[model samples]
Target: YLKKIGRRGKIDIWLVDGAKIRRDLEKDFTNFAEYYYFPIIPKYEFWIDRESVPNERRFFIDHLLAEWRLMDGGMSYQRAKEIANQKELSERKKAGDLEKVINQKSEFSPEKVHRRLLDKTKDEIDIWLVDGRLVRSAFDIGFTEGGHDLVYQYVPKNEVWIDDDVFAKERPYVLLHELYERSLMKSGLTYLRAHRKASRLEWRARHSEQILDEFFLKFLIKKGKI
Candidate 1:
C-alpha cells in the first residue's frame, strides 16, 4: 500500500495566509526546504500558496488586485496576504497545477450540511484545513474566512478557512462562529461587535448542545426510543 501510495504523498501544509506560511514547516524542513514563495514581479513583495483557489469559474483576480490598490502598497496587511495568495495561485495555474489538485472537487466543494449548520448561500463554499502553525501566526485562531460574498447572510460566496489543529468536537464551533458572524455582518453590524455577539451565542450553544447530546446518548444506552 505504501508502494502504491508512492513518493507523491508529500504533505502540503496550508496556512491561513501566505506571509506566515513558513512559520510551521520551516523549522521541520530547514535542511531539506526548497523555498517556493518569492517576491512578485516589479515591486517584488513575496508571494506564496493559498489554501486552494478554485478555477471552476471566471475570475479577474489580477485585475481585482490592481483595482484593489494592492500593487500601490496601499493595501492592508490582510489584503496584502490575500494578494500574495492570488499571485501564487495565478503562478500555479501557469504551471498547470490549478484545477486538478487545487481546483478539484475531491479537494473542496460546498455542502448542504457542514457539521449541523446549513450553508444556504447561493454559491459554493470552498473549505480548507490549514496548518496549526499558520493559525498561530494569526493569533491562535481556530478559523478564518476568505469569503468574498456581498451579503454574507443571504448570499455568501464560497470560502471557509479552518485550522487543522482544531479538535473534532471543536471544529463545528469554529465553523459556526465564522458563519454566524458573517450573518451578523450582513445585517450591517460592525465586525468587532458582530464577532462578539456571534461568539457569545455560539459558545452558549456549544455547551448547551453537549448536554442535549449527552441526554440522547444516555437514553439510547438505556434502550429508550427517540
Candidate 2:
C-alpha cells in the first residue's frame, strides 16, 4: 500500500506498507527507503517504509533526496550512492548516535575476536561486525548492512552479521532485529515471516523504553510463553 503522505518540491513523499504482501510476494518493496520516477505519469515519488524507526525517518528521506538529486543531475548510481551514504552517516553522527568502529583489516575476513556474544534472550547468539563493502562485494544481496543465517554466508549457522560501519548507538536496534528474526526462524517460521516480525519489533524498540525487555516480552507473548 502506497499512500501519499506529503510533498517536497516537485516530489511526492509516500508511505509504503509491505506488511500485507511482503511474505507471499516478496516484492522488491522490502526497503527502508526508495525513490521512483514515473515518467509516463509525469510524477516523481519518494517512498519510505511505513514501519521505519521514527527517529531515522528523516535521515532516510534526506538520503533518498540527496541521491535522487545527484542522479537526476547525471551522476552515476555508484557515485550517487556513495555520496548519499556518506552524507547519511554524517547526519546520523550529528544525531549523536553514530558511533563508528574501526576494523584492522579491509577484506572479508570474518573476525570472530570482535564478535559480540549477546545473552539478551535465553539463546546465546554471536554477532560479527563485518565490513559492509566486503559483504556487498562477496554476496549479491541487497541488504544495506545486515544479515543473518537466513542467507547462507559468512559466520556460523546461528550467527548474525552487522556492518562495522554501523554506529554504536544504532547497533542495538539492528542487533535486536537480527536476533528476533533468528529466534522466530529457529521456532519454525519462514525467513520472510520472521523478517517482518523482527522489523516490527525493531520499530517498537526505537520508540519505547526498556527495548530489550520489551522485545523479549513481545516474543513471549507471540509464542504464548508468557
Candidate 3:
C-alpha cells in the first residue's frame, strides 16, 4: 500500500508496524528518500529521549532568563540554583545506574531542590554592578511557588548571566508557557489573562473526562460485567 503511493513526488515514510510486512516489500520500500522505524518503545513515555531532554530544558530556561534578565537586568541566585538542580537530576536519570539510588531515596527530591534554591537566593540583591560600582537595581523581583505567596529578592550582578543552576528547576509547563509567550511576543500578539485561564480550564475538563472514563471501565471489570 505504501509503495504504490511513493512513485509521485518526494515521500517521507514512517513505518510504525513495518515488521509485519514481508521481506520482499521491505526491500522494495528501502529505496524511498527517507524512512524511519519505531523499533523499541521508550521507557519514559511522556518525555523525550535522555539525550534531547537537556536541550529542551535549556531552551526554556534561556527564554525565561532572557525575559527576566531584560526586566530585572540580572539573574537571581534562587533561579540559578533551581535551573542547575533540574539539569543535574536529568543527567543522573539519563545515566540509568542512578535509578536504583533514586528509587532508594538517596538522591535529591525535586521539591527539596527547589526549596534549597529559595534558601540560597533569599538574601541576594538584584543589582547591576559595573567596574566595582552598583549601577541599577531591579524595581520589582518576585518569586512564587504554586500560588500567590510572593517572595521578593534584591540581587546585584554585572550582567545577566545564566548559570547551570537556573536550568534544572524549570517545570515543563513553565517551559511551554515561556515558548508560547516568546512566540506571541515575536508576533506582536497580546495574551489576555482571561483567555489563558479559560484554555487551562478546558484542558482540565478534557483530562477529567478521560480519568472518569478509565475509572468507569475499571469498575465494570471489577464487577465482572465487561
By TM-score, the best candidate is 2
Q: Rank the candidates by TM-score, best first.
A: 2, 1, 3
Error of 3 at 82 (Å): 27
Winner on TM-score between 1 and 3 is 1
By lDDT: ranked, best first: 2, 1, 3
Off by over 4 Å in 2: 1-34, 37-122, 213-226
- Candidate 2, residue 25: how far the Cα is off, in Å: 23
lDDT, model 1, position 133 = 32
List the candidates' TM-scores in order: 0.33, 0.47, 0.19
Q: List the residue pairs that clash in candidate 1.
A: 125-158
Candidate number of the best lDDT: 2
Against the true structure, what is every candidate's RMSD? 13.3, 9.7, 23.5
The RMSD (Cα, Å) of candidate 2 is: 9.7
Q: Runs in model 3 with CA error above 4 Å? A: 1-139, 143-170, 193-226
lDDT of 2: 0.58
**lDDT tens readout by residue for model 2, 43-87:** 377766554233456666777888889978888878887888777
Clashes (candidate 2): 1
**In order, how many clashes per candidate?**
1, 1, 20
TM-score of 2: 0.47
The global C-alpha lDDT for each of the candidates, from Candidate 1 onward, is 0.37, 0.58, 0.26
